[model samples]
Target: MNTVVSYIKEWQQALQSEIQFLKKFGSNKFLVSNGRLLSTDGSYSYYFETTTSLRIPVGSSVRLEWGSMSQQGRVLSSEGKGVILALEQSFGDLISEATLFHDPWELLDHLIERLDEIKKDKQKRLRVKKLMDPSMPANHPLEKIKSNVHELVLRSKYNPVTFVWGPPGTGKTYTLARTAANKYFQEKRVLILSHSNQAVDVLLGELTDFIQKKDRFREGDVLRYGFGTGERTDNRQAITTTELLQNQDPSLAEEKEKLLEDRKLVKQDIARSFSKRDTNQLLELETKIARVLEKIRQKEIEFVKDAYIVGVTLAKAASDPAIYEKTFDVVIIDEASMAYVPQAAFAAALGKRVIICGDFKQLPPIAASRDSLVTKWLREDIFHRAGVVDWVNDGRLHPHLFLLEEQRRMHPDISAFTNQYIYHSLVGDHESVRKSRNKIVESAPFPNRASILVDTSFTGAYCLTERTSQSRINIWQVLLSFHLIHESYLSGLRSIGYVTPYRAQAQLMELILEDLYQEQRLNADIIAATVHRFQGSERDVMIFDTVEGAPQSRAGMLLTGKDSERLINVAITRTKGKFIHVSNQAFIRRHVFQGKTLRQLVEHQVKQLQTVETKDIGKWIKHQHLKLQWMHARKLENVFQDIETARASIVISLPAHTRLSPEWLEKLNNREKIVKLTVISESEWMELRPDHRVAEGLSFPFIIVDQQFLWLGLPLEGTKEIQPPFVAARLDSEKVSEYLLSQFITRE
Candidate 1:
């Protein structure tokens, strides 16, 4: 263990140095070494005898040697300097942290302690009574069911916050509707919201049905209603799952048609090449057509209109804050993780008591660095906040609750896969549910079950694809797929949803639904997507695409951040038996790691650790600075690695350094090929000429030019046109070495 720990620590130090180097250098080249040393910041002619010690320039001549760790060599020189910033080494620190997540039993113990306290508090508030009613109990029939619903509502009402950790197929939405109905019947005005439109529709339907069927509501009345369906006089259009399907523009249909036609043309071209017996032309044509077809297919996404407009309209709906402030007694928010801060703020304005439901293990919100409040707080400053600290320390906070050891959705096999890949600590073939009917699936085996296909393909590429901006990899695709699969697998029952965080993703889904209606004329399914789509919502089936990408492979791919998470919750909670993912591997890898390749770094470090000696611990583990502590380095590295390994194949983390000549740099900066120059004085301005330095191991190509050609040389005026060449040198020290080095080394 000490040996392992020591290796982790050493990797941590190396990683820190790498980060500092990157920050200082920005995009400059660096020197790297595994077991090699060179002249300190000077030209070194004494090259190593072995391949591992080869003093190659950073960006140039450093050939990548693939082999077992022991056989591989580290870099010695880059750009004539002895420092190639090792990003892969920097990423190794995170790997150590990931290995520590094998057990959360301590966390569970803390939760159980607080849960008792919560229960005791509830007991003190209630007056226990025995009900005796053969035909009708003294208490209402609704009260006879699960006390968990009322308990959840009560928790929210008193604390003004509560978390509902609804796993797949647990009837999360139905329970939410019942809870809201009870609150409403108790004269508490309740507002239900979800992040996805589909979840919202499910919640509205369940609540509306409860009001209409069970409560004996009369016809031609607004007593029974959901958010966007049927009729309402509250100036609110309850957008039914069906009504939402009609609001999209028909332009998407036309775009999709044109794309199909172009695809046909490409196929024909390929066929023609093959018919002519030209294998080379056929292959080239096939490649070109594939690229073209990808472009056409990405043109199908449409905006989810109603969902987006709701936020703006919500502002307009109730001009006086009091309308929302006092009208609702309790507000339930679903898919809280997907909700943006602004939307959450707006929802908070509605009432004092708000119930938020979501799982943090799934997708997190997609936000710019500046705007990502949740991620920023959770990652960096969470422990400083008292509320957050209480949750982490006590494991029982008012805002969140762990749904300990319960899972209802997924067949045994599919659920197991999801548990291994996505969710953790909850669900599965645990002892508690071994004999219970709550097994993953009734009869479907892992191998033969109707699989929730996890497709990781991009439909769009930047150079070739063009489509309606809103539909390009919208998160709603997961929600729609969830409904399609869940309804096919789970019961005919649809669920209820509550909006939380915000409604932005749901709005996007609406647009897609409209396009679907126009193109497929298939509107028989009972699914809904809404802002904050489905909080306090649950169903029988769920599908999610956490990876974002272009409409086709041509447009490229990326991850689905906040949007995917919200939709995933909606998809899982909406179904009782299934969960699926249609994703782009490249997209997820890019987004989850966010510029840092965590998985690769961790794996590399772990491998290194496996071979280290026990006594070298001080070299790796010891850190003088508080910020560079062993645990901190370990945790960050592990997170990076977890995401990296989870979706490894499709994503790549580029080398930290790239090499370029001064001429090439100028060209790149200027966005052109030719170098521009204006000369004046003979001494200051010189013509472009070859500067040949024949020093061993220090020669390369050089083009000596005047200061006038360099952008950093001097400033120009209207009358003077140019200044002196004090800033630029025709043959600098670095250039001279490069010219000489080229003479000694192989050009390639």
Candidate 2:
């Protein structure tokens, strides 16, 4: 037998043995029931019934799995009836740990030893080679990174590992796809891996799209494994490795088709046997189908080994014995920083060259304890470790590591903070980002300010509610987000998101936003998510609600850590157009704030807001020598009051519903001779009802006091009462005011 085949067979046997062990010893089935809580002891007991007579030693760690969720707990007590278990934490924690499996400590140790042996062997050393196509110009958005990737691939011939540092919005996925396509076109077999199935799918989608656009990719050029066939409905031309391999040989395809037809006939026969109650024939047909499936599986493995490119999640690749049988020229791992070291190393072992793309500054691999020595040695990602090592001093980065500098996702002002503070001036500005900044400035209510920090220092504005052991929800922040959302929509920004650090706060904001959406007061498309959940995504406008307000110590505790700084960095960089930080000033001042990036932003916004003097509508009208339009029936008294004090000429367009007495009209007509008051009855305004509400619950009863400021009201349609919760912003541009004016105009 061939060496590779023998090694694969051994690995397969080991996997089977492990599976059998888990089935017999690791997995435990129990009948679970809620136990009564003791009021005096404050201890809640849960009862579990064992399927078989067993001994669950006290203090032993165990996991309870049911209905797509699992929870970690300890055996508090055990008896013949069942065992009592005390949960580690909340129910959600249990669901999160459901994906957690037994650590492959022994396999990882052996792989590391093999890696060491490979590293020490001079004959097995890598030799660097330049890109086969270095003449390809950098024309794509991520072409610079792609070029760097080619260099990395060249270096990978000499080095086992190559790293790409892709900051947020730096087009890491695009670079990975382009590089993979380049290698595939060269007829180099490649294997793509990621810890997340979603990440793998994203890269696969990008590759498929790239292949479809180019003439080089054929039907059987790329094969996707692990992902369901139904999931690729959008790209039906793409086939699995098994199907591609089967298609390569007409004999195999013919045989497979014949077997499939035979299996169908056998199934029909089994149905007939079942209906006739013939158990013998049913069992025989079942055996036949099983044999046919085994043949199909073998054929799939054979085809998979021959594919030019294959994609799978790290977990799938690590467990599937067939993946170990073939050697890949290049192994590209996306989101490598989030992968455990062992998982990434196992995938890397399957290829000669390893190209890893990820941002280590965003989120690290989830672990039970970062302080654990075993976790630090085993779970710390290779990409993350490589990033921390100062390879730039030795000028070795060209061959082994590529740090993508240009960020295209955030406005200059927004990216500047991340560039200066988190990245230490390593990130460069993109020309497109400058254009985006200018465009947002041209339309912003306060165009000069790209970042705004709302001061919730007032008594009621900084209130924080502790909802869980790990989460806190801020009411003031949610309310401020609503106001910002309204303003953002009016500014023509359709894509908006609200990000918070606490899951509870995120849930609360979602509830509030949902209610606003149902009432037609806010856009339903706007998303609210925790910072971790919103990673790898960007929005035109981002409202970050740091739900850490007084008491000062609680807020300090939440914001004073490295993890908190990473969360802040991610939240700040998610905006391409506008960034708003809603937090209490008191909390910000506590302990000088460890992270300089967040501190600088808070100070900048405080200075900007302080420089701009606050002016009400009445005060604004007094300063302008312009025409003012007072519309609506219920707000006429307040409008008249502001107009009485204003120096500007006023034009009042009243709704047809306003039944002004004849005497009042005569007085107004007489006064029109002296005062520059032109009364225009807007007959069409009467036809505008609540059913004409636009976007959220924003209506057309706005007070346009010239082109300086527009006071837009939020009212539920068909309601008699108009609420005071209205958005008042300075209208710096006449085009914006004209847009608002157009909404109230009647068709001629």
Please report, in order, the local distance difference test score of every candidate based on alpha carbons: 0.34, 0.56
Per-model TM against the reference: 0.35, 0.58
lDDT of 2 by residue, 281-317 (tens): 3334434545655676687686676678888877667
In Å, residue 133's CA in model 2 sits off its true spot by 29
What is the alpha-carbon lDDT of model 1 when measured against the actual structure?
A: 0.34
Candidate 1 deviation (Cα RMSD): 28.5
C-alpha lDDT of residue 508 in model 1: 33
Q: In model 2, what is the error at residue 731, expressed in angstroms?
A: 28
